[model samples]
Target: MEEDIAEIPHYKYYFATFKELEDKVDQIELLSDVIGVVTIVQDLEKSTLNSRITSCRNVTIKNVENKELQVTLWGHKTDLFDDNVLKTLEGPVVTIFTSVLVKKSLGKPRLSSTTSTLFFVNPNIPKVEDLKTRFQEDVKTIKFLPSAITTQSSLNEEKKENRKTLVKLLEIRPKSTKDMRFTVKAVIVDICEKDGWYYMACPNCMPPVSQADVSWWCQKDSFINKSPLAWYKLNTIISNQTGKMRMMIYGRVAEYLIKEPCIQLVTNHVNQDKRKFPQAIIDVIGKYKIFQIAFETKAIDNVAICKKVFDDETSEATNNRHRLSPPINPKTPDPKVSVNQR
Candidate 1:
């Protein structure tokens, strides 16, 4: 097996980026093919009422732009994927999904396998190498700005808070950032676990930063540093009795809500209990909280319409921010001045 494995050659599997998929997904008929590097490949499972047994896997892929799309494969397709693309691993397995169906699942456009769908496990494609070359540059652009922003720029962003609209999750328009004020009175119904709900990042830059050659790199400050100052990117599913949506709470705010740097909880999860969720996340789940939401319809074609949350909490929800923040570190200014708590 070792001698045969070495015979496999590097291949390319190229296809559309998430943005292209998003654009053509609406036409459905026109979305004849889809492709990208699969970052995550989940396990298979079954459900009741169907003796044949339904199997599926959720896949997240990124483009040269670092834009991502979620895809799910079912039944025969899943079996095929597991047998071919997954099993044919000679090295770092690179597979490309092709001729897929674009469908709406939970309000998001996800690619799925159709009768004509095909799989290419590390085929010779130029675009694949192009993707590798561009991935780093794109990560820097999407997750962090190579150049740091001025303190004045930060102040101006804070000033825009007054002009932002205070509305609900259900009322946002596509690409309309102006006059967009909204908030949601939501209860955490479920805490999802695809990426373990939290991500490591740089504090000041809010990084989805990458590590290379045993060193941490932050495109925001263009610096290499250690792990002293870090934060999280939190993901949760929230519901306001009226509707439910996926909410991403970024660092600082997540720190404000979780009450501690998430690293502690993550460490506890890793060293103490691998199967259980961290206590901090458990505490927030099922709790009533208010979120100031931005209505960016361009995201996943209005997937649940809840995006870019500011840390503003409503008085009607709960006055928990105070308890969430530590006494040290610069005191958080009261947000009540600009927002209606309830």
Candidate 2:
């Protein structure tokens, strides 16, 4: 004799945003399902590194209850329908693969489906509020997936790594502007570590000279005397194998790197020793050229000079070539400042 099996009733669920569905990851079973509307569809082709390979389509669907979830279709599913399918699919019943695993990032849980996961469209799902109330009751029985929740251990590790990579200075070439053949190097001269930000000054301007505000004035006869000299802001992009990041450098740092206020050449006499200014410095301004700047990551204990130069000119040039100071000692106060009584 054959045994009779009972059929399970399909429960209706609704969600408005992706966050609502995240907590329900544990309650869903392999055969459990949901009905929702397709809200967004993005092309993943550009995300792929290779040209010859095609990528999957990432779709974000919102349930009748306004719950949002992500769906990725691979292989044949990519070409199964057009915009018409996307438009019509917004207001109906749909079966989702609940057996699929969840991927967690930054404490958020995201659903991941495999090739075996299936989806079927049904035109009869509840329209709005009615679907929402039904889902609220059903969510009570849903449990939180242990694997989906981000643990404190993982978050601590992430924070530790980020602390090490806190960028002091970033360099990038500007787009949409003419390539200023001049290479710009920004250095972080001061930092408010408490605020998680640092101050940069242009290398050319040096420190004390460039650290002026609008009120401070220069006495030079040229433009320096006519207008208030202040530090400039630089915007650029920096990237590595992991990804690209944008940074903004301001104040003294910008002035130091661009050497904006510093004149490049001096005048000399043509026949005798009379002064005749050379244009070499002016011509090199904003000219694009390649140069490298080294950043001191940590402190060095001792210095050993392998080669010694007795000539002043050669020694000065050599010193300039390796001109980087050790990290500032936080505990040491500047000796130039005199203590004032209250």
Candidate 3:
């Protein structure tokens, strides 16, 4: 058997770069092979799939081009990664994943392992050695920074000493049209169903896409020959005792309340009445949440966009106790606040 395998011709390999895979992120008709230097390996996680629990893990890989792509290993594939051994290995760890299908989660594209997928780490192959050499050369010129989420959270904790009421939030004027981030405590007073509950989004960039004949199209990429993903684009009125603000709760923030993927909701909603909002969305009407809102100054409309949503816990008391610091420009008006009737 070993002799027979050795006599077989060397398999012709075609590896994709991070850029190519990202551009056709919504395409899964063909499987792909990817090679990169292992930069970050996440812990094994478990989730329910088809009524059974399954294990998976994600690792961030960087190509010689210094572009990062996340590869997710599922089921038995997760065991192929020897975490302890990889941690102890010296120099850059060249890893390869074969026969992966592209999938999108929360609007970001990632490689998902199929049943035929193979995992390799530092294999005795010429391609890996060449990649390792190039990656090592590039690493010298690169300065790594902390993950964006970690950095943003640290900055928010530093500057977000107090949460603002809707009234105070409206009082502050931005220096420019650039979006300003703020944390607020508010209750969902009503769900705005004017534009329906969700949108068909481009799987790569998460922007709304329209169906153009057989293909889905968006302004960013023109026509994408891939199925668009249904993502949450919830509009609602949120209020504290001070005032109410029209807010847009998008993507995962809306998913956090709906407790289901927008794709599933879209499937069920296709035949349903178009005038009514999904029950899952309606259920959150009276719920209170701590929202990290982004105020877009360029828009003439008075709507606060929600970036992150948190559970109302001890933060509510802290919000009421402390006042929002004066705006960036003290000349900004501090208008008398009035509560809006629900």
Best by TM-score: 3
Residue by residue across 1-342, what tens digits does model 2's lDDT show?
Answer: 235765454744432245445544432222233445444556433222111123455656556546666665555555653434544433332434434444455566556554555564543444434554545444322111111233444433332331212132233223311222222222222222232222222222322232255433222321122222233333333333233233344442333434443222111313221122123212222222112222222313111110100112223454354334566877766677677721
Q: lDDT of model 1 at residue 53?
A: 28
Global Cα lDDT for candidate 3? 0.72
lDDT of all predictions, in order shown? 0.54, 0.35, 0.72
Alpha-carbon shift of residue 123 in model 3 (angstroms): 5.2
Q: What tens-digit string does per-residue lDDT give for candidate 1 at 45-130? A: 44211112245656666755556676667777777766334533432334577768776667667887766677775566666566
Report, for all candidates in order, the number of backbone clashes: 13, 29, 0
Query: Which one is best on lDDT?
Result: 3
lDDT of 1: 0.54
Query: Which tens-of-lDDT digit does each residue in 12-81 have in candidate 3?
Result: 5579876667565645446789888888877776643322346777788888778788887888988877
Q: Name the regions of candidate 1 deviating beyond 4 angstroms.
A: 1-168, 219-223, 226-229, 267-276, 296-298, 303-342
